[model samples]
Each structure stands twice: as structure tokens, then as C-alpha cells.
Target: MARISTKSLTNRASWLVLRRNRIMTIGETVGILRDNDDFLVVTHIRPDGDTIGSASALCYALRKIGKTAYLYNNPQFGDSYPWLAEPYLAPEGFEPKYTVCVDMADKGLYPEGFKGSADLCIDHHPSNSLYAKNTLLWPHKASCGEIVMELVKELCGLDAEVSELLYVAVSTDTGCFVYGNTTGETLNAASELCFAGARNAFLNKILFRTSSKARLALEAQILSSFLYYHDGKTVISVVTKEMLEKAGANEKDCQDIAALPGRAEGAFTSVTIKEIDENSCKISFRTNGLVDANKVCAMFGGGGHKMASGCTIKMNSFKAADTLADIIGEEYK
Candidate 1:
């Protein structure tokens, strides 16, 4: 969690200049789109709020302009996101001349069936491999939703659908605006979405509402599995195969319980380990400040932003715990 030095900033900036997107500015993106007539929208495998918001917002805008755009993602995404409108459509034999990746840099993140070149990538992640003919990687932007908001304003102005989609993208990426990434620009854009009829009540009722019996039982189990250290400065928990099965829990239920440990007093990081199977585990890392989870994630062949990031460990449960602890311990050194 060490702050990036001046040298690091210089390096990142130079890299940006060599392969920056001129259409990152709203005016430029709109001009490019107005002339183009085909697009295929795609996102990372486990689509989050930013992915859902950006893909729907951009696809909807494209359709508004009389262009045809198709959407596709891993099937597991549908299971995790029941509240969404299922904007991704993939009819058999459907194809597009160009594909658009939203909120992601690498096409490999799209799971097995979705592997190929994308014509464009609208993303804010630094790990992006520039896997598109045209790309926009804005680390300073709070979310891909923010980038799409810029596009919405420039292309056709904000409408009701655009407002709702953009709101979900921004709110979720910022952790309800409580995270460090929220900025004045994000707030202003959110306000515009509100004015265009984005309803907070409707979004929350669906996103947070628990309807599964397994989910309730899993929550109870997670509440009791807590372990603390350093005067409660660190909180850790594990969800093993046995624990999950006894609770009738599934991977979708694991998502919500992952962030609970950061609630502990004096804690800088909350680590949640969920056994994806007997040999592999998914790790969710959340930090209040000064603990870069992305560094830990990178060690496991995964990458994301600093404060809220994730990684997958291919080792068994015991080795996974040791690996996580060691990586986090290095941050303290």
C-alpha cells in the first residue's frame, strides 16, 4: 500500500501518452460513433455494476443512432445479476464486424466462449493490455460508467435509460459514494442522471434484496467465522467447501459476505477466502487505506484496482491462506 513515487507517476504517464485514446474526450468519441454503424458490446466474465451499466448504456445509445449492436458475456454473469434487464443478447449465428469491450482491458477476462479481438475498449483499469484497435484507459476516471456518461452527453444527450444505467455504474464502483474514488465530476454526472429520472429506490430494492434461503444461511455462517489480529487491526474469514455445503451456499452467496471484515476496528484490510472448488479459491480484498490488494492479486495472476481488488489462488485452502497472509504482511513491512 505504499504510495506510488514520483518516478512511478512519470512512468505511468509516459505509458499513457504512447497509447492514449483521443476519443476519451466526449467530443471525439461521439464523432467516431456517429460515423460507425455496427458494434458488439462485451464485458468481463463476472460482470459488475460498471460492466452492466457501461454495456447497456453504450449499446442503447448505439441503437438510438440506428446502428445494430449485440451483447454477450459468460452465463454465470446472468446468475449473479438477476436484477439487471439482461441487456446482453446473442442469437445463434449472430455476428458483428466490430466488438466493443466495456470496463475491461483484456479479452481473456471474458471466459472461454468469448475470445477474440475487439474493435474498441472503454475501460478505466490500468492492467488493460490495449487489446483493441481503439482504446480508452483512464485510471483517473472513477468508473467505466463515467466514461460512458461523457459519451452519452456528447452523442445524444441524457435520456431516462441512460440516466438509470449510468447511476448503477457510478454508485456501485464508488461503493455508494463512500470509497476514495468519488470526485466532483462523478457527483455532477450522478446529479444529471437523477434529473433524468433515475430512481434510487427501485435500484436498491432489486440489488440488495435477498430472496434465497441459502443466502440467509450463508450470511449467518459468515457472521460467526470471523478471525481478528493486531488488536483487531486485521479481520479475516474463510468459506471452505464444507462450510459452503453445510450452509447450502453457492458462489453467488459468497459475494456479499466477502467485505464484512473491514468493519472491524483498527483494521486496514478485510480478507475473504471462498473455496471455488477443492483445489482453487477466490479471494476478495478490501482495504480502508494503504493496503494495495492489487499487488496481492497480481501475485496470483489476477489484477484490479488498489483498494478493492480480487485474486484467485490455484493452491489448496491452507496454502492459499499462507500466500495471502505473506503478501499482506509484505505491505506492512
Candidate 2:
């Protein structure tokens, strides 16, 4: 695939914004939700706050409008944001008139064996696959949650549940509003949610300020395995399944671990490799503004935001680590 220039990417976003008749708007989306009695919202495979919050908020807003809505079953839900997803699980074989996917850029990101197509896709990734029949994509937005907020506003459902859910979605994706993606619009959306009853201080403590013992131990093990290259301009960290076992940690305890290597002093690019199996691993790339992490991950058929992206490699963890480091360094060389 060829690299997309900033000019072309910006033009694509602007075109989507102007061609509202082709892509669905918040009002059109609301009309769909209102007309459909049975709605099911699906998040990405490895659930994150943005996906979970966006789906959960959409489900809640649908229910508030007296529509039947449920969250699709995601195995990783319990690991990330259980509170937001617990009460919304779709019952077994619940047929949905409208199957909507939130925060999923590619169809491959949907859970395994989910063969049905989505009626709509709501997302913020610049590289969205446009796999749905109708898409509401705002690449300029910091998080899908920000777009969800617009839907909630149009539906007149800006209560505490919606507020806090959007807060989680926006905050997690933007790294508590400190990431390069964070813009004035993002902060303003967060402020509105706060005024509407999002407990920002409390959520900040739970999501950022606090960590469990297992998580701390896992972090220590990962840090111990950190490797540097390119004169410390590139860094890599590994966390094997055995390491997680030794730390008494599971998937839930490894939240934000991918960003650990990038926080190193003088690091320009970082990679985190997590062993999913003996022969395969998941790799995440983080960059400090100059190198586009999306471009690095795209080399492996994966892409996300410019600063953060990920892919899965069918190679041993150690080899995957070395390969990712080499590719990232080569990209910036």
C-alpha cells in the first residue's frame, strides 16, 4: 500500500464531511436507531475503553428512546470495562434489526465467527476500511466517543451514564487528553460531559492514578525486558505469557502496557510485543510525533492513529520484537 499524504488525508476527511448525503449523519443515525426496534452494537475484538464506551453509550441512548438495544458479546469485555458492558450483553441468538459496529475500522477487528455485515460503522480512524453499508467516520475527531456525544446530544440523552461513558471513551483514546491527537474540540467535548455529570476526578483516579499489584508486577517484568536500539532512539519491550503468569496478571492487568516503552527518555519510536502463543505475538508501535506509527503497523496489514498502531505477527515473540524494532528504525532512518 502507498503512504497517504497529510494533504490527501485531510481532503478525504473534508469530502466525507461535505458529502453528508452519502455518509450518514448523527440525525440520520438517530433516525435509524429510532426506526429499528432491535439493535445490537458490536465492539472490536480486543475491547478498549473507546469501543466499549461508544457502544455502551449508544445502547443506553437507544434504550432511553424506548428502543430495544443490546451490546454484542465480546469475550474481552470483562477484561477492560466490565461495569459499562455487564448490563448490556445481547441475549443468545438475539436477532437484531440493526447491527451497528462502533469504533471498529476494519471488519477483521470484529470478533471471530461474526459473519454478518454491519448496517452502519461509526469510527474516528483515518484508515477506516469503509466496510459497512453506511459509515459515519470523522477522522479529525480524537475519539469515536466524541462522535457518540454528538449522537447523544441529538437524541437528548446526555445523562450521567452517557456522560461518563463518553468520558472514558475520549480520555482513554487521547491518553487523558495529553496525546498529540487531543484538540480544542476534544477538550471542549470532555468539558461538556463533565458538566453533564461525568465524574472526571473520580474517573481520572481509577483509570490513570491507580494500579493493581498484579499490574505493577507485570509492568516491572516488562520493564526488565526492555531493549534499546538506534542509540536509544528506538525501544522494544516484551511480555510473554509466562511473564504474565509469573506476575499473576491477565489481559485485564496489561492495560496501557504498549505505551510503556515509548515513555523512555530520548525514545523516538517504541514497540511492545506480547506473546499470544508460542508461534505468534501482537505488536504495538508508538511514535513521538515524527514517525507515523500507522505506517509502521501498515507494513503488517494493520493501522491506527499516526502515533499509535498495532498488528499481529505469526512469529516467535523474540523474533517479532527484533523485526518490529528494525522496521520502525528503518522507517525513520
Best by lDDT: 2
- Extract clashing residue pairs from model 1: none
Tens-digit lDDT string for candidate 1 (1-333) = 122234644476655643543324455557667877667788787777788788888888888778887677557665466345366475767777777888986666774488667777788876666657677667677788988888877777888878888888888787667666788988887888889889866775665554478878877777687776545666778778888798887767665566567766678888888877778988888876577877778888877777777778888866677667767777877
Error of 2 at 197 (Å): 0.6
By TM-score, how accurate is candidate 1?
0.87
- Minimum summed lDDT over a 10-residue window in model 1 is located at 1-10
Worst 10 residues of 2 by lDDT: 1-10
- Write model 2 residue lDDT over 1-333, tens digit each, in one string: 122334554566655543442357677777876777898899999899999999999988888888899998887887898898988999998988889999998899997557678888999887787778778888889899999999988886698878999999999998898777889999999999999999999999999889889999999888877899889998899889999999999889988888788788998888899999999989888887678888878888999889888888899999987887777667776
Give me the runs in candidate 2 sitting further than 4 Å from their true place. Answer: 1-22
> In model 2, what lDDT does residue 253 have?
95
